[model samples]
Target: MKLYVIVSLWALVTITHQIKTQDNCVCEFISSEKPFPYDKLKMMQDSASNCNNLMSPQKAFGLESLLLGLNRRLPQLEDDVEMLEKEDDGELYGVLSLYVIENELTEIQAMIDKLNSSTSEHKRLGDDTAQKLEDVKEKMEELETFDAMQVMKKQQANQRLKRDLDQCRNGGLHPRPQPTKHTEGTCPHGRFLNVTGPRVFTTGEYPGSYKYGAWGRDPKPEEGKESWHWLVMLTSSNIYAHYVRFYSTLSSIIVGVSTPGNVLIHPSNPTTNTIQGPNVVLYGGALYYNCYNKDAVCRFNLTTKSITTLQLPKGTRYNSKANFCHLDECYVFTDLDLITDESGVWVVYTTNQDFGNLVLSKVEEEENQLLSLGQTWRTSFPKSSVTNTFMVCGVLYATRYVDKNLEEIFYSFDTTTGKENLNVGIFIDKMSPNILSLNYSPLDQMLYAYCDSKLVSYEVLFEKRSNFYL
Candidate 1:
C-alpha cells in the first residue's frame, strides 16, 4: 500500500510535466495488472487536483494564439461597422461593403468552430469571456442584415434617371428629354480625329496681371458681333470678375487691343451676380458663369444687359468642393464648368447624390426669354480626377496633366449613345503650367484653353463623316 502511494505521487508529477509541454498527449491512470480497491479511487482524485494546479499554465497556451487572431479581426470589424453606419440614402455605398464583411465573418466563424471543438471537454474560457464572445457573434449577425447599402442603391438609381425640375414642372411623368446634341451632319468639321497645333496664342491685355480667366469667340454672336473676341479676367483674388473685355478681331486680340465699353456682370466687384470661378463662356450674346458663392449658373446678357439664373441640381459641389486637380494644385472654384461645342451650351458639375461623378446639363432659353435648365445626364467619371474638360462634336473630352508642358485628353463621355470612352488619348501642348478653362468653337473648329496667364487655341483635326463627304 505504501508503494502504491509513492507511485501515485510520482505519476501525478510526470503527468503535470507532460501537460506543460503542450503536446497532444492524454493523461490518465488505469491499473491493468489487477483490479484496484475502491479505496484507491480517493487517492487518485487527490492526485488529479495537484496535477491540475501544476498544469494551469497549459490552459493559457491553448487559448492565447486563438485570442490573438480574434483580437486582430474584431477591432477591424468594429471600425468597418462604424463607417458603414455613418452612411445614409444620400451617400452611395453598395453591395461591395457586404462582400467585405462576409469575407471577414467567414474567417472568424472558422476560428469559432475550432475553438468549440477544442474546448468541448473542458472550459477554456471563463463564463464572462464566453458570454462576451457570444455577444460579438450576435452583433456580427446583425451587421450582416444592414440595409444602408440597399437604400443608397435605390436612391442613386432614382437620381441618375431623374432630369431637370423645369422639365418635370412643364410636363408631368415621362418628361421630354432635354435636347443635348445638334443635327449630326450640321457640323461640317465632321467627327473629331485629333488635336493639333496651338493655332493661336496671345497674352490677353491683363497678361501676368491675372493668372486665371476665359477667352474665346461667341459661338452664337449678336448681329455685327460675329468678328468679336471676348476676355474675362478674374481680377479679384483670382475668383471674382465684374467685367468682360471685348476685342474687335482676332488680329486685334493678338496686338493686345484695349477695351471699349466692357460688359459688366455686376456693378460692384464680387457682388450678387458677378462671375465666380475661372470657367465662363461667351455664347449667344451672353456670358455664362457660376454665380458668386452659389451652385447656380448665371447668364449675363451682353445685349439685354439683364441677368437670368438657373439653379443646378441639389448637392452640387460648389465653393470648390469638386475642383479640377493635378499633382501641383487644383484650380479653385472650378466646380461649375460651362463649355460650348457644336451643341449650343452645356454645364458640367458634380453632386453628392451622384457620388462626386461628372454631371452634364444643357442650358436652354425659354420662349419667355429666361434661362431654364434642360436635360441632365450623370456620367461615371469622377469629377475631381481631371485637370480640365471640353466638348468636341457633342462629345465631352476630359484632360489631365501629362507633364508640365503636356495635357492629355484621356476620357470622353458620349451622351448620344449613353456610353463612356476612357481611351480617347488626345494630347494638348501646354505653354503654361495648367489649363484653367477649355472651350470648343464650332465656327473655326478650334479648341481654346485658358492657361495660367496665357490664352492658347488648338486646331481640331477631324475626318469628314461619310454622309457629309463630297
Candidate 2:
C-alpha cells in the first residue's frame, strides 16, 4: 500500500509542471508578435531622462505615465496567467482574452499615427494662409499713400493759378482792339471770301454759302416743323461786326429784331454792343449767349420776343485777351462759352472762386426764361489758353494753341468722374482760321466750327459709344 501511494504523488507533481509550461508558451507567442516595439520603451526612458529639461512639461508627463502604466500592466498579466494555470478550467479563457486585447492595441496605435500626420499637414496650411494675409495688408497701405500724394499735388497747382488770375485782372494783360465803325445791313453773299488751305482741300471745302446763323436739329421738333433750322445773324459792320439782324430760318429777311424792350445794351459800350463771344447755342426754341463782359448769361426767347439775363459769380473774367493765341492771331475777349449737348445748354467759364480753373454750370430755365443754375463741376484745366472746347456726354474736350493745320484734341475733363486726362493723341484733321468756335451736333453726329468767316463740318469717330452724349 505504501509503494502505490508514493507513485500517485509523483504523477500529480508532473501534471502541475506541464500546465505552468503551457501558460509560459502562450505569453511568449504574444510578446513575439507585439504591436508596439519593445525598444520604443527604452527610447522613451532616454527622452525623459530629465523631466525638468522637457520642452512641454504636460506632454512629457503624459508619455511617462503611459510607459510606466504599460510596464506595470504587462507584469500583472503574466502573474495572472501563472495563477490561472494552477486552476483546471481558467487557463483556456485567460488566453482567449489576451488575444482580443492584443488586436485592440494594434488598432489604437494605427489611429494615433494617422492623427499625428493630419495635425502636421493642417499646421503647414495655416502658416501659409497667415503669410498671404500679411502681404495683402502691405499692398493696400502703399496704394493709400500714393492717392494722398496726388491730392497734395492738385492743391498746389490750384494755388499757383490764383496768383496768375490776380495778375490778369489788375490790368497786367494787353487790351483788345476798339471798334472803328458800325453799319446796319445784311452782308451780301460772296462778300466774306473763303480762304482755302490743305486742311480744307483734303476734307472737302466749306459749304458754298456762309450760313451766318445758329444751325442745329431740334431734339424735339414741333409738328410740321423742319428737323433742321438755321437762324441767320446779319452783322452791322462789314469788318469786326456785331450781330444786329436776327433772320428767321423760314425767310431770308430778319426776324426777332432787338427793339428797346428786348435788347440789353452793354453798360460800357453801345455802338458795337453784342454778345461777348461768337458761340451761340439754340435749345428749347431759345438762344443762349455769353453776355458777361463781367457776370451775366443772356437768353433770347424766339416766340415771346423777350430777353432774360442770369447772373454769374463775382470776379468772372470776360474782357481778357484771348487765352489761346496762335502764330497769326489771338482770340479776343473769350471768357465764357455756351455749349449744348444731349442734356441741354451749359456755360463753360472761369471764376476767381475756382482759382481760374474751368467751371461748367448747367443752364436751368423755366417757361423760356432763365431760372437758376444746375450742378456745377470744376475742371483742372486752366481757362486761360484753351483754343476751343466742346462737350460730349458731359465730358469736356479742349484743343490747344498749336498749329491750326495740326491741331489736336489733347485734353479732356469728365464731369461725372471728376477726372482729367492729358496727352490725348486725337488729331483734328480739318480746321480753318484757328477754329474760333466749336460745336458738336448730336443729331447729325458731326463737329461744326466757325473757322475765320466760314462754317465747316467734320465727322467724329469714337472708340466707345455712350447714350448720355447723343
Candidate 3:
C-alpha cells in the first residue's frame, strides 16, 4: 500500500506541472501580444522570447519548449506568408524609411526645377507681348496726332482760297445801275425791296477815313422768308441802314439803318416837337413810341396790324426810352446757343448800354402775351462799344472793339458766377479793319463779321466735355 501511494503522489505532481505549463502558454500570449504599429514578423520574434522564458528549461524544455516555440513562431510564419498584404503603407521606419524619403525628395526637387523653368519662360513671353502692345499704342497716338495736324492745315488752306475768291468777285465789273432802278419796289410775295447803298469793294487807302472801305447791306442767303433779314448799322453812316427786303440763312442780315432818336426840345417852345422814331422791331408787336421825346421800344404786329410798346422797367437816362442804340442781331437763337429745345428765347439787339457794358436783351413770343424777357446777365468788359453778343453753353460771349484799328477781342463770362474764364484769349490775330456789325449762325456754326464791304465768316467748333465732368 505504501508503494501504491508513492506512485499516486508522483502522478498527481506530474498532472499539476502539466496544468502549470498550459496556463503559462496562455499567459505569455496575453502579456506579449503585438501592438497596432508592430510588424507581425517582429511580434512573432518577441513572442518566441517570452515563451522560452516562461516555459523552457535552462537548457531546453523537452517537448514543451518545442511545442511552445511552434505556437509562437506559427503565427509569425503565417504573417511572413501574408507579407503580400503589407502594401508598403508608407509609414516611418528606421534607416530604410529615411532612405525612401530622401529619394522622394530628390524627385520633388527635379519637378520643382521643371516648374520654375516653365514659369520663367511664360514670364518672358508675357513681357514680349506687353512690349508689342505698347508699340501699337504709340503708333495709334501718332496717327491721331497726324490726322489732327492735317485737318488744321486743310482748314487754313480753305480759308485762304475763300479770301482769294472774294477778292476776285469784288474786282470791279458791272457799271452802276440806273438811279431809276434804285426806286423803292416790291419783291415777289409783295415784300418791299429797297437798296440802301451801292456795293463797293475795299482794298487799299481811301479819303476822309481811318480806313478806306465801302459800306452796303444785302441779304445773307438772298433767298426766302425763312431767311433772316438784317438792319445793318454801318460806322460812317449816321443812320442804321434799313435794308427793306433782304433774306439770308445767316444772322448778319441788313434790314434797315435808322438813327436812335434823341430827346431834343424845340427851340421855340417847351412841349413842342415830341420825339419820334423809325425804331421798330419787326417781330416785336408795334406800339406807337415816343417816351418823353425819345423813342421807346415799340413793335408793330404784322398779323394783327396793332402796335404795342414793350413795358420795360422804368428809370434810366431817358426813362421809357426803349432805344436799342446798337442793334446786333434779329435772328433765332436756337442754333446759336443750343438751348432752344428747352425754355429759351430769341435774342436781339446786342448793345452797350452803360458805356462798354454789354446788354443782351431779346423779344420772344411774337404772337403771345405770355412771352416775356428771359434772364439778363452782365458781361466782363464794359458795353460801351460791343458790336455783337453770342451765347454758348449758358455763357454770354461778346466781341468788343479793342481799338480804332478794328482789332477786336472776343471774351466770355459765366452768367451764373459773373466770373471770367481768362483762359480764352482774343481770337482775332489776323482780322484788321474795324468790324461795323457782327452776327452768328447756328446752321453754319460761324461768326460773321461785316467789315467795310467784305463779309467774313469764322468757323467755330466747340470742345466736347466728358459727361462725368458735367
Q: Which candidate leads the pack in lDDT?
A: 1
Candidate 1: pairs in clash = none
Please, what is the TM-score per model? 0.59, 0.47, 0.34
What is the per-residue lDDT of model 1 for residues 228-276, given as tens digits with 9 covering 90 to 100? 7888888999999999999755544554544343877667999898999
Which parts of model 1 are misplaced by more than 4 Å? 1-188, 259-261, 465-470
Candidate 2: residue 78 Cα off by (Å) = 99
Best first by lDDT, ranked: 1, 2, 3
Model 1 lowest lDDT segment of ten: 176-185
lDDT of each: 0.74, 0.52, 0.35
Residue 466 accuracy (lDDT) in model 2:
34
Of the two candidates 2 and 3, the one with more favorable TM-score, higher being better, is 2
Encode model 2's per-residue lDDT on 309-334: one tens digit a residue: 88777767666532444556556655
Per-candidate alpha-carbon RMSD to the true structure: 29.2, 43.3, 48.7
- Writing each residue's lDDT as its tens digit, candidate 3 over 368-470 gives 6533556665454544334444444345555554443333334556554666643333344223344544443433334444454443344444333221200
The residue ranges of model 2 lying beyond 4 angstroms of the native Cα positions read: 1-223, 231-273, 292-294, 326-328, 463-470
Best by TM-score: 1
**Global fold similarity of model 1 (TM-score):** 0.59
